[model samples]
Target: MSRARAIGCDGGGSGARLALVWDGLRHEVCGGPANVTSDFAGAVAEVSGLLHRAAQLAGVSLEDLRGVPAHFALAGVVDERVATRVAAALPLEGVVEEDRRAAVRGALGERPGHVAGIGTGSYLARQGPDGFETIGGHGLVLGDEASGAWMGRALLKAVLAVEDGVEPATALTRQIAEEMGGVSGIVAFAAEAGPSDFAALAPRLLDAKTDSAARHIIVAGADYIARGLLALGWKEGGAICLIGGIGGKYADFLPTQMQKALVGAEGSALDGALALAMEQDG
Candidate 1:
C-alpha cells in the first residue's frame, strides 16, 4: 500500500491537528488536546488515534502509515528528554519538538522577527539568520506566564482575594464567584483543574472591559509577554507576530510601540509543522 510521504501534527492544550501529505494530495484532521508533559500516556494515544482516523479518511490502510516520518509539534514537550520520551512512545517514526519552532516558523517564516504564542500555554521565540531561539513555555506550573491558563489562574486568585477581603469585589469577581458556586466551589475547581480547564475561564478576562480585576490580570499577562520578548533580544521596530487564541488579545494591552511593530502571521503553526515534515522526509 502506498502511504503518505510525510505527516505533520500541531498539538496544544486546547486541541491537536494532524496532516498527511502524499504527492499533491493531503488529508487533515483535528483531535482532542495533547499535552505530552501534562499527560504523556494520554497524549501518545491521542496522536495514534488521529493517525488511524486520518488513514481511514484518506482511503488508506492503517498499516500504510508505517515508516512515514512525522514532525509532531506538541505543547508541554519543552526539552530533549521529553522529546525522546514522546518519540519513543508514539506508534509513528518521527521527531518530536516543542511547539514553539512551528509557531515561530509559521508566523514569521525566515523574516527576522519575534513570535509570541499565548494559548493554553505560552512560548516566545525570535527567528533570524541564526535560526530560532526561544524562552518560556515551561508549562503551567512554572512558566507560561502570558498564557490563557495563566490569566484563568490569576482570575481565580483575585476571587480568593475578594473572599478574604484583601481585595474589593468587582462585577466580574462577583459574577464568576456566583457561577462557580462561591469560594468553596472555586477552590474545588482549582484543585482538579488542568491547563485547558483553567484556560477555559480566560475568555471572561478577555472581554471584561470595565472589570478592574480582569484588567489587572490581562495587564499582568501583557507585561510578562513584553518582558519575555525583551529578554529574547527584541528591539524597537522589530516585527512581532502574535499567534494562538489568547495571543492576539494582548494587542490592546501591549505598549504602543509594540503594537506599532506588530505584524500579521504568514501562516499557522500547523503549516509550519507540515513544512518541517516534508523537509525532513526529503
Candidate 2:
C-alpha cells in the first residue's frame, strides 16, 4: 500500500512546530519565528524548509511529499487576505485555519468551550455548538494586553519607576533590566526577540510574588484575561480551558476571582493540527 502521508504545522508568535504523519506513525520538528501573518513570507519559508528537512530526515524527498495533505495553524493569520497571502507563499496543498481554531481544537478536542492561551501573546476563543469566536491577540506591541509580553513590559515599567526613584519596590529593580541585558539591551532584544523572550521573564517576575508590585502585575494580567472571557459571553457553566505556555505555567498565580473561570486542558495546537490531519486523511 502507498504510504499515506500528512503534515501539520502551527506557527505561534514565538516559534513554530510541525508534525508529520506517514502511514500510522508521526514525527515532529521544531521551527523558529514562523508566525504566518506577522512574519508572512519569512514564516512560510521557515515552515517550508522545516517540513522539507523533516521529510528528508525521514528518507522522503520534498518532491515525494508534494500534494501530500498539510495543515497549517498560523498566528497573526486573521483574515482571508492574510491566509491567501500565506497560501501564495507556501504553495502547499492543505487547510489553513485560524490559529485559535487550531488551539481550541487541539486543547478541547473540538468540544464546545472557551480555550484561553496566554503565551508570549494572549487570546481567548469560544467554540460552541453554533460556532467559534475570539478576543485578544491583536499583537505583542498593541494587543496581547495580558500576555507574557504584557507581564514583561509591566515588570520593566515597574523597575523603571524604581530606578527613577518614583516607586520603590521590595525586589531588586536593576535585576529586571539586567535580565534583558540592561535597558539598551532590552530595546535591542525587542527588535529581534520573539514572543518567548518576553514571556520568559514572567517566571522570574513571579519569583518575587511577595512583592506587592509583582503581585499587582500578575493580578492585572489575569484581569485582562477575564475581560477576554467576558467578551465571549460564556455561560457560567460553560467550560473554560486554559492552554499555552504561560497559561499552564502561571495558572496558579491568577487572581482568585478569575481562578473559578478555568477548566484546564490536555493538548495544544500541535495536537489539534495532528487530529485535523488525521480527520482529513480519513
Candidate 3:
C-alpha cells in the first residue's frame, strides 16, 4: 500500500506557500497574494495553482492528489462562513483555518506560548492547556495594530501632520514627501491604497535614520504589539515568538519586558499546516 500524502498551505496578504509531504519527503511551491476576505476568488485561484505545482514537484500526479489530504491556513478567514466559501471554491479535500492558529502551532508546537504575527496584517495568539485564543486580527481599518500596514499608515499620517502644521516638519517627513512627490503624490497613493500598499511603506519606516518622528513611530508600533501580548495573557518571562515579514524587525524596539519574553519559533506556518494535515489523516 502507498503511504498517505498530505499538503500544507500558508496564505497571507503578500503571497501563498505550499508544502507537500509524500513518501517521507517534502516539496515546496510559491504562489501570489491570498487574502481570502479581500478577494476570495483570487485567493482560491492562487492556492489552487500552488497546490498543483507542489504536487508536481513532489512527483505526484494531479489525479493522485485526490487522495491526499490538504490543509490551508489563510489570512482574512475570520469565520466559518468564509472558510466554507473558500473550501467550496477550492478543488481539494481539507480544512481551512485562520492564519493566526497556524502561526501559533508553527511557532510553539503543542507547548503553551504566545505568538505575535506582524506582517502586512497583525494578530496576537496564545496557546494554553485549554486551547488557542487570538486577538486583534481585524484588518487595517479596525485593528492590526503594530502591523506593517499600521506602520505605513502611521508614516503617511506623520507626513500629513507635518504638512498641515499640526506637527513640526522633520527630516523623515521631508524624505517621505520627496519620495511620494510632495503632498499631491501622497494623496494619490492614499486614494486607492490597500493593506499591502501601506505595508510597502514599512521598510522605509524601518530604514529611516536618526529622526525623532521615525523613532516615535517605531516606539508606538512596538508598544502596540506589547499591549496585544499582554492582553493575550502573555507574561514577562513567558515564551513569545514573533512571526511574519516584519515580526523580527520590531524585536529591538520592543519594551524591555517583551524583549525578555521573545523566543525563536519552532517552525514555520507551513509546518503547522502539515501538522494539521497529518492530524486529519490520522
Best TM-score among the predictions, by candidate number: 3
| Residue pairs that clash (backbone atoms under 3 angstroms), model 2 | none
**lDDT of all predictions, in order shown?**
0.87, 0.75, 0.85
Clashing pairs in 3: none
Clash totals for all candidate models? 0, 0, 0
Which stretches of model 3 miss by more than 4 angstroms? 1-4, 62-69
How many residue-pair clashes does candidate 1 contain? 0
Q: Any runs in candidate 2 off by more than 4 Å, and if so which? A: 1-5, 53-68, 162-168, 172-200, 253-261, 280-282
**Can you write out model 2's per-residue Cα lDDT over 183-212, one digit (the tens) per residue?**
576668667866567677788776777777
Clashing residue pairs, candidate 1? none
Off by over 4 Å in 1: 1-5, 38-42, 52-69, 89-92
lDDT of 3 by residue, 30-140 (tens): 888899988988999999898888778887776788867778999889899999989988888789987777778889877788888888888888998757898886878
lDDT (Cα) of model 1: 0.87
Question: In order, what is each prediction's RMSD in angstroms?
Answer: 3.7, 4.2, 2.9
Sorting all predicted structures by lDDT, with the top scorer first, yields: 1, 3, 2
| lDDT against true structure, model 3 | 0.85
TM-score of each: 0.82, 0.78, 0.87
**lDDT tens digits, residues 97-208, model 1?**
9887887878976689999988888888898876789888777999899899998999999999998999999999999999998899999999999988999999998889
